[model samples]
Target: MHPTIAAAEGLVIDWTQMPTYNTIMSVAAGAGLLTVVWLARALQLGKPARLEGYAVAFGVLGTILTLTGAHMTLTWPLAKYFPFDNIIFGEPSLGFGVLLLGSAVLLWRRRELPETEDRARELAAVIAPLNIIIVGLGLALGAIAFAGLIFQLFAAPPEEPISGAFAQWPWVEATFMSGMFGVTGIGAVLFPLALRGYRAGAPRTAWQWIVGICIGLPGLGFFLFGALNFFTHVGLIINTMGS
Candidate 1:
């Protein structure tokens, strides 16, 4: 089973199947634009509107989708045998590319739905802050993603059937995916809690509880992940330079 093979798509291809044109642009646009829109709303820079909320939500999702596609690309070297190889190239563009573009376009087009002051206040006082934080973390993740893109471009081509710890390391991929899940998974676990929070009359607070856990606390995990990555990389650099 080729790691790049897609039983879903019914064919296979290499991870570097094509240039990063479509996938990279889509992901980056999602993260970067959405982050901007969210931060603006959070800071009260614009009129209270659904566009702001929508932007942030799509942005984080875009960032996640891009990360998934990017990681899947690593299978070329990492895979013992990629099962989805045929599907990778045969079907179409990289994973979720078209859907993302369509969603972004639709989101942009549908920004002006009629709503009430009550809803505006709710978006402003509640979802903006939390969504801002989520989008901001997404922006950070997108930046880290550049490392992989650079590796694909400037670094020497992997040894045919690339070897070394990187080729075999599942933890690297798992860590990235886990980080994304930990942040958004809260929403899945606490949908009813979120609805309750929304309905309980959007009182702004330093912490919002969702599904029995404080939202602010779970939110901190994304920052912690970034700090850990920075220090780890810095330590590795210092050790290498010393050697």
Candidate 2:
């Protein structure tokens, strides 16, 4: 049996915890759903379907706010680097991710770039930053979740394995990894391809592919990862008692 703390007229029990894994999972799931929504619209005959053109403009702005918060978590309390957690810094990458999406939208709307096969190779340069965001986020989230899982397992007595599709451990790597894996990577890859198609004079179908793959996917992924990170970690946070 795990140990419990004593409290006035009550038992202060500490529950097992796992948050990193959960966050990543949310990120991934959100990305997945968005992907599906965009795909369905791509097949339409008219102008490509969109989540909301102007609304998506907030993509860049929202990313900036989010990155700011994430950076704070890493630097101050989270201490995710030297003298603290050694996982990785993903804030910059997410910034780049938004930049990629924003830029692509701008390019598509304006139709400034000339359409040519040769341009495809050159255009890749524009998309490189986006890919970096995807990789950086994926790796960082995965590593952090893994680290959290180890911490949680060691924090308490180990439980025997139970039969089930999923284990109920407070920390699990998949949760966070799922989050990181969401919009950024696959979307990063697909966006450019679709954007490249658009630049190459491809139809709305091509552009929709990019939007579906990128923007649509994030909501679900973030929600899932956020839930995992929040619920699992809350119990382990060492809450203070009011006298």
Candidate 3:
């Protein structure tokens, strides 16, 4: 039996064959593509309404879709391989929920403001102070994730089993994922507004660029990595269908 087919059906005893895993992956990839477009549009300036719309949609609806797709991917694994494990099921679920809630707040705030550069600057004022703390926390989390990954690479025994590796390091994966979201989804997306605020002589302080750079670097890295992954998934899907 193909590993993909077996893993796809592992949770369902009654189903002889299931394409659930592939379907979920496909959905996730679709949502991810939307997110990429949303992010791109949000990054552009000149039109305030379009900018706000893209930001709100990307932060709120886009993240929601991504979370749903992630949950679908997690379902079979949780039900089959790690039924007794709480962290495996809990971390990503809870982390994504937090991300969604944060996005909701951003959406609500953006909706309340009028579509104008002044209005955008005012919103950036509101975000500038909060960004410092959030980006600082994101950086700390990123450092910890890097440390963990280094340890995993250098310290793990040569004889350690390769199978179920992700299941074995649930916290590491969860923490890294959380950091990635914080840096890319929250910090990177919001920092542009901070830059705008600085340009407009708004509430942003001079030193804020340091925070932006810290968060932006990781955000770019995550974006590139995700792009690579997305293309890889696309190639896999194409090959699968061709066969």
Candidate 4:
């Protein structure tokens, strides 16, 4: 009854009874998948000098992850701060994923030239201001979250469980705390720089740097967290399910 592939496919556990480590890693995997997909699409679009295409798609991916993660009990700071729900149903997350994916697909379909400079200019002008606003907001909020995480590292424990697994494995707490900063920090900082490079299109120096910082480092963080979680807690998850 271990949580092997078959077990995961067929296992049945009440939502409320699921452990915190399982929820954290599961949500991380989903979010990471979205990031990878968006990164691939961005690279393809950027090759054709379609910076706006990539920007819009990347924005959609990030927007969905941030807003949806803030709502999901597994990933949200609110879930830890409040007490109403632990693991909300996955339907809403799935719906948002589909909406963002569909948006990306539509953008991909229209990646070719519009045959009119006026049209392209109009779209770029509109998106430029929006990009600045979105990236600015992301940076501000990420800084706030990073600060909160730091405070938690040193503060007294709450009577309620901020992270249940932290009691058993302190690394679990670090995983969530550092992972949040890594994900959000990378996105907020690197994205604006990437967009600027995308727009410049001259020395062609920005694209690789953008991809490296934005995708590579965050990806490494996710992979590290996943490895650590598996090594430290996968057996526990399997055993809990079997029991």
User: 1 or 3, which is superior by lDDT?
Assistant: 3
Per-candidate TM-score against the hidden true structure: 0.36, 0.43, 0.43, 0.46
- lDDT values, one for every candidate: 0.37, 0.41, 0.41, 0.43
Alpha-carbon runs more than 4 Å astray in model 1: 1-57, 64-69, 73-107, 115-187, 196-208, 211-215, 237-243
TM-score of 3: 0.43
Candidate order, TM-score descending? 4, 3, 2, 1
Report the lDDT tens digits of candidate 3 across residue range 88-157.
Answer: 2233333433443564466565665544455444544555555554454445445544644454421211
* Model 1 weakest lDDT span, ten residues long: 153-162
Better of 1 and 3 by TM-score: 3
- Measured with C-alpha atoms, the lDDT of residue 157 in candidate 4 is 20
Q: Write the per-residue lDDT of candidate 2 for residues 134-180, one digit (tens) a residue.
A: 55554454454454445442122122112111334444434443344
* Candidate 4: clashing pairs of residues: none
**Ordering by lDDT:** 4, 2, 3, 1
CA RMSD per model (angstroms) = 12.7, 8.4, 9.0, 9.3
Residue 90, candidate 2: C-alpha displacement in angstroms: 6.5
